[model samples]
Target: MTIPEPGGPDALLWSEVPDPVPGPGEVVVDVRATAVNRADLLQRQGHYPPPPGAPAYPGLECSGMIGAIGPGVAGWEVGQEVCALLAGGGYAERVAVPAGQLLPVPAGVDLVDAAALPEVACTVWSNVVRLARLAEGETLLVHGGGSGIGTFAVQLGVALGATVVVTARAAKHERLRELGAAHTIDYREQDFLEEVRRVTDGRGADVVLDIMGASYLSRNVAALAADGRLVVIGMQGGRKGELDLGELLAKRGTLAATALRSRPTGQKAEIVRGVQEQVWPLVEAGRVRPVVDRRLPITEAAQAHRLVESSDHLGKVLLTLG
Candidate 1:
């Protein structure tokens, strides 16, 4: 998928492109599947661009087999099954990726479904677990719990023994609860702050996994418990807002914002290795499952983008290659 020019979903064109060749310490993956993300949508709309030296396409992660390996690459060979966290270029039949960013598919995950794991797993684990330090017995509040990252966080938070609360549509509440959300707030019909307070008996969340950036800044602070951590990874709801420093200071709340892409290769590799060591086992044991909403052929990349923009799907939308 190539964007002729940044515009909308219609801007995506599925045309043949040059096959990627591996650079030193890199490998070429014969991409079997790639999943859609909000970053991809932003890139399609001209708001985001690939990092320096990364592919110019819009995808952020992919799963496939190693087709070729560059000199100095080790522990992986051609024909090995793997998925990778990419800065871009997953929207093609093949993509060149750093060797260290690659992860072997978990023991029980299907090849194509593995495409959904890399971005979300690394994202949630790095933010909620590493940054926020959400521990057992804490209460976590997740916004957009039906989203890809939200779904992953809800389950992982639960698996780690936290009482999870989520804000999503009423239709998605039952599924979110089944996935271990102790409380679900229908954002459309309820106030998330009130719901969080009610669920935790007047104590707010220990941590908040927030995607609506500036728009939710004030409320996120309001919903935090003392010493709470709020990690913002996306800005779907506009970019500027006023912060109540006094409020944040009173709560002793910590705020952080991060993006997986644009990080140095060494940082990405570290995150990948952590995911492999920590999250992969939970996946292999069937404690966490990939929540893919639907799959479309790569040629219909525009349709996939449209579906994601609609926000009607529960989990991930994937684009499959031949």
Candidate 2:
């Protein structure tokens, strides 16, 4: 897919593009599937662009078979089934991926569905587990529980022995609970901060994985437990908001914001390695699995984007190729 001009979902033009050649330490993947992400939507709207040296197209993760390998890349051979975390270029039939970012498909996942795992696994494991250090017995509050990141975070938190609480639409509450959410607050009808307090008996969440940035900033701070950590990964609600440092100080809370696509290749590789080592095992063991709402052909990416933008899907909406 190529975007001649950035605009709405229709801006994605699935036209011919030159084949990608693998550079040193990279491999070319004949993409089988790719997953739609909020970042893709942002890029489509011209609000976010790929980092330097990345493909102009938008896709953050893909699953496929290795079609070629570049010099200085070893331990991976052509024709191996794998998935990758991409900075961009996953919207096409093929993509060149840094060797370090490739991961073998988890033992039980379908090749197409495997595309759903890389981005969400890396994001949640990196921020929620590695950075925030959400320990066993802690309470984790996940905003946007029906999203790819939200669904993955909910499951990962549960797998790590935390009590997971999520704020999502009432329609998604049942599914979120089935995915291991201990409490589900309907964001449209309930005040999450109040609900968090009620559910935790006023202790609040020990860790919060937030996506609604500025709009939720104050309430997120107020919902934090003493010594809490809040990791903000998206700005769907807005980017500028006032933070009550006094309230954060009184709670002894910590706040961190991160973006995955802009990270250096080496850092991304490390996160990929972390996911393979820690999260892949959980997946193979069936403790954690990819949650896909539906799959659409690559050519219908505009429809997929419409579905995601509408917030009607429960999990990831995948784009597939032959």
Best by lDDT: 2
Candidate 1 per-residue lDDT over residues 113-187, each given as its tens digit? 999999999999999988889999999999999999989999999989999999888999889999999999998
List pairs with backbone clashes in candidate 1. Answer: none
Q: Write the per-residue lDDT of candidate 2 for residues 211-257, one digit (tens) a residue.
A: 99999999999999999999999998999999999999999999999
My TM-score estimates for the predictions, one after another, are 0.99, 0.99
| Top TM-score model | 2
TM-score between model 2 and native: 0.99
Candidate 2: misplaced stretches above 4 Å? none
Inter-residue clash pairs, candidate 2: none
The list of candidate 1 runs beyond 4 A from truth reads none
What is residue 229's positional error in candidate 2, in angstroms?
0.2
Model 2 residue 104 CA deviation (Å) reads 0.6
> In model 1, what lDDT does residue 100 have?
88
At residue 99, give the lDDT of candidate 2: 97
